[model samples]
Target chain A: MADEEKEQQKQGEMEELPVILQLRPVPAITPVEEQFLKKFRFLKAWESSMPTELFLTTYAQSVRVLLCHGGTPVTADTIRCLPSLQCVIATSAGLNHIDLTECRKRDIAIANAGDCYSENGADYAIGLLLDVLRQFSASDRYVRQGLWPVKGAYPLGSKLGGKQVGIVGLGHIGSEVAKRLVAFGCSISYNSRKKKPSVAFPFYSDVRDLAANSDALILCCGLTKETYHIINRDVLLALGEKGVIINIGRGAIIDEKELIQCLMQGEIGGAGLDVFENEPDVPKELLAMDNVVLSPHKAVLTPEAIVSLQDLLMANLEAFFSNKPLVSEVKDE
Target chain B: MADEEKEQQKQGEMEELPVILQLRPVPAITPVEEQFLKKFRFLKAWESSMPTELFLTTYAQSVRVLLCHGGTPVTADTIRCLPSLQCVIATSAGLNHIDLTECRKRDIAIANAGDCYSENGADYAIGLLLDVLRQFSASDRYVRQGLWPVKGAYPLGSKLGGKQVGIVGLGHIGSEVAKRLVAFGCSISYNSRKKKPSVAFPFYSDVRDLAANSDALILCCGLTKETYHIINRDVLLALGEKGVIINIGRGAIIDEKELIQCLMQGEIGGAGLDVFENEPDVPKELLAMDNVVLSPHKAVLTPEAIVSLQDLLMANLEAFFSNKPLVSEVKDE
Candidate 1:
């Protein structure tokens, strides 16, 4: 969990074990690499005494699969060094860190964390939403500060039931969030690029329309050109004075400056943000507000999700070795 | 809302309207007395210049309905003054406030909150459990204190999915908690006085055994002679160092002293306590711990739940006057 920069190697003595090449450690937060060591040997470029370029060239002809982490970018230049890399296994759902163009051009197959973190992501979104509506974090703070006795009853929080909650995306994670919110009796509508044929939740083609109707807008969409600063001033105003926003998606998906202003001006009621525009460095203004609950981009950092991710990564690697179709192949766009 | 000690009147002009007698304003936390004003007239004793006993004596023959709040006790002495008091309508689920013995002796019907707060209770229970398991309060605190960038990553939290959760007293609130947790993929088991005949959830007659098998124990049972201090040191030990305790039930259902020691000694994983044995005066020790989420017993204080309670109270009063069986009348044991 320390985010160690130095890439490491494990399991050297096994003679017939399958090998997976790594530019760096996959997912630096969890020390789950120890689990991976038992089944597959890692040929890490960062562990080499030689330069990384030289290390990659050494394995260029033989390396069939490459393991990529979110922190480490899989650049076209690096991909050019490996002539026979068949597939790229990613530790993140977002392909921003991995060069999809390079992979697509090379005809290299890919497997991201496909539904491996859907449950965790969904759970966190609802958790943040609940925290906002019920003022759980605020109540916890009042008690922790020994102010409960001094400050009488904390202000009453609104209920999740009978509230109209709109989801920003309705993909695997968004759908899971919708399902959980349904259990709380929240009516869920959603905004995706297009209306999902299988999803019954009412869909909005525009973000502004979704914000206008929703009591809270939970951001579950990925950050992209179309989605950058999607939650801007207009959306925040539409969400209104008593509305809340819970972001489990990328931080930049929201217009952070406008969000901060809305929170400060009480244009919006409250926010439960797991991701920030610049993670680790939250807005100074938000720290003082009891209405807002901030987290350091830890939506997918649950133990069960980690285990599932490890399984998915292992399965993808094994699938490549066995010449079987990948279990969650990233479809070619 | 302030806990107003002075009882006040809302309406006086309505003629031929049915009167519901109030010893005090029902449920002091919400100032929603205005809604009650439109329906019925109140014969409030506190508003009279005469002594309270004299006020009751004047209306003894005509005052057929009595209203009670949680803070205002309707003792046997008071009930004796109202010979025609045919029913007692309480603002709380617990009947300890009104003289249940006196009500039963006179065959006076009683209606408590019943299932009015059930949905809110369940929502808060799951919310607290999710807070404990996922460390939302801790993560929020870290970000609020400007520790995210300095701290890098918050510690990984355990997932709710695939974990065994045990409910203590699978009643109305407990059932709702089970329904929500199941949507999150949590396996639920319960321990009640007897296994619920209609419920398919695995049952344990003993609390200790339920704690031993559960990753978390959610206390949703009512506090009775059989259940007071049901969760003691032995139960906490059975729950073990990795198990969480979520108290949505009465505070005394758990032995506060033993729970504190468990949390302090790391005998239990954590706790999400909404009710403390001594509320408004939570133990100082629990205030400093990051693992515990302490709330001021606001589980059923949601806006929607309040409206539901208002409707239920009105329905019960109307039912009593219409010669119908009370919707949520407390059964004589």
Candidate 2:
């Protein structure tokens, strides 16, 4: 009788593995994603010879979950095509690629990459800040160019210890940055939209005020209408000639044009930028500056973070299938 | 009556101000050094018209304290020339700059910059490690050279979290590095001459064994006869193709030629080097590699550290003048 019961349970498990619809191929599906594929069957729209609409009409009719990333835009029209789509899972932190209003109207649930990226993102932000302050990259260039022998001792870099570091947003990533820097003897303060009652770090409601008091400002806030161009000329001037600015957030969070001008004219000390206003189109003038450090928007791309993202994505899918609370759901604001 | 008392106190203070002989001009003298100058009169050797030997013999008869930096070596002969010399105050960490054998033979006291550079040196070691592991400098070069647009996204970096880091010489700077990396979730292990009884991190008796177990090796041990070329080919190969090396300690601790070959052949993953075997003359072949981060031997040149060094130097001088125990005196082994 026990054998028969086990047989029934095995059959039930074998028959009930959930299906996840793929709107397009992910740029690179790592081993973690491959592991997810072994558990769930995918209805890949791009692989179908039929048009996207026809493919959605036929195959996606029975699919309840959609797996998407930054490269693919799950527009309202695309959402309208999938009648049975109840959940959209994003593999990236930012949701600008998704049409949120349409999903809200449709009463569909959304889950993002969540806290998987917070640690690595924070680490990268600190790395960029250190590179700028210590002239790590700039000195590397000097050494590589055979200038170290010709130029003698490189200029001294500012110390990170005891510097007033103002975090632009004390969100998950910002908080992680604060934790890591505190170990280096840096004092932490922050400016966010609202004061977090649970946090111990000093908070300021105005970013300009925070800039005035800070030796360095690390931008980690989300990109929104209110935050767009938030770090403008006034904030730069307030930070003064000895101040540094580090941005791991969106490009437009700072006024790139003004920042370029300030950096060129010595109006500000330096900058460490992961994201750019134009991206791939950094100002040519910045190429020669010894104080600036630039990266191509890759603060969150780490193998460990990607693996954690895969786990979170799988957990959200599993929870949705079992009628459980979404593990990392993005609720409508 | 108060005015007369104040005048007497001022005269006593003027009589007590220490006289120090300056062997050479420092690279740059900040306000802190100037403040020191106000407290003590410096006999500038370069400003004197007589030959250095003549100047020392003529003006050094009454001099008891000598001030020198790492660049100006205080040879045994030079120490012997100043018969009245009682103390040598070094503005650098390493004692290789001064003739310790002569100082010990004559029972002359010596003071070094102690604990002043530990914080900045540790900060720089972490920064260089971060740059190498995360490709901070490489990605910066990519963005600066306008290659980001042409190249889609830079390759993913390995996460710092959960990595096994082995620190060589668990001294002041090594301990500080351990403290900082712990917050990043990295596991710490160490290899020194002897196991530290108080330290909780795992200790390895042999460096090769440490390299075999660790994903990264941070060199912080002083360069001595026993430690010279300690990180040789065996250790590099033991660290293997995926391992990284970070050196904030002196050069010649690792075999530079072998390190270059390993880095070129992918025998070891990468390196973050502040001090090279031949400093100001880094291997030109390393110029093209994205895996290495090079600095111009400036792990401890911060303004804050310089100020602390000034304070420590002044305290050492004052302690010597007052017949008090030298604050950071280097005792002969």
Model-by-model DockQ, in order:
0.73, 0.73
**Clashing pairs in model 2?**
none
Q: Supply the global lDDT for candidate 2.
A: 0.87
Candidate number with greatest TM-score: 2
lDDT by residue (A129-242, candidate 1, tens digit) is 899989999989888787878978888898888899999978789999988988989999999989989888899999999999999999988776789999999999999999
* lDDT at residue A220 of model 2 (Cα atoms): 87
What lDDT does the true structure give each of the candidates? 0.85, 0.87
Model 2: per-residue Cα lDDT at residue A296: 88
Worst 10 residues of 1 chain B by lDDT: B3-12
In candidate 2 the C-alpha lDDT for residue A289 amounts to 88
